[model samples]
Target: MNNYEQVLVALRRVIRATDLHSKRLSKTAGLTAPQLLIMQTIRDLGEVTIGTIADKVSLSQATVTIILDRLEQRELVYRVRSEKDKRKVHAHLTESGGSLLDRAPQALQEEFIRKYQNLQSWEQNMIISSLQRVAEMMDASGIDASPFLDVGPINRDHEWKNPTQRDDRKPDPASKLKAS
Candidate 1:
């Protein structure tokens, strides 16, 4: 294969690996990857608004709302109307939700996290910066730029390298090739 094709193939493999991991996590934990992610965010932020959760998870507000609905149905989470701003709603994990999170496996595959964590700090930073640069080259730079700016350096003190930080999964092969 040509260089470009080889890169595309590598990217597709990574995407497939992630998808397979997510599906396995869902089966084992009774929560889809996104649901586990949102639950973890709510646990970390403690009674955060829908928009905040969406931003944390790199998903749209509407998509978050739909996921919240499923979570609510399962009694894993509930929404509360803000007392001071009734129009605004915040999502909070139920007792069950917290327990679920405590027991649920991490969204990232164990093997992926293990390999990622073993990298030296500089190596980790380099990989992250390279990935971000590639995202920008692909015209996705603007999508999450505000978050990096709002929080200062994108990889501040290795925050982005945290194993617990929920990252968006790579696009499926069909979508990636179509974009290419």
Candidate 2:
């Protein structure tokens, strides 16, 4: 295979890894990647507003609000109007939300982060620059993307996983591959 073909294969592997993890998370915890991330942010920041959650997750306020609406419907979280100000509202994870979060698998990025942090500073910088160049090549440099990874609709519910499928899991094989 050519050099370009190898690059495409590596890119596809990264994408497939993300999708597999997302499906596993959905099956195990009944939450999409975005939903889990928003909930985690809310829990970390406690009683925050929609804008705060959005900013913390690098998503738009409108996007956060929509996810909040879905979470509220699932009774995973609730919002309260601030007594001191009628114009203000704060989001809080419900008891169910906290419990589910405790049991939910860590986000795919968490594993990548753990591995990434162990790399030498120069190696880390090289990876960043290479990925940035790839994004630019794909005309995706200007796209507004949050940090989390999930393939389906951002507002999709926990019931999105397939019941018939089973995972015969293994360590991420891609992690062992090095760019030449």
Flag regions of model 2 displaced more than 4 Å.
158-180
C-alpha lDDT score of every prediction, in listed order: 0.73, 0.87
Residue-by-residue lDDT tens digits, candidate 1, 50-134: 9998888777788789888878877889999999998889999999889888987776644566898999999999988987887
TM-score of each: 0.60, 0.83
For candidate 1, the TM-score is 0.60
Alpha-carbon lDDT of model 1: 0.73
Q: Can you give the lDDT of residue 81 in candidate 1?
A: 96
Which candidate number would show the highest TM-score if scored against the true structure? 2
Give the Å shift of residue 25 in candidate 2: 1.2
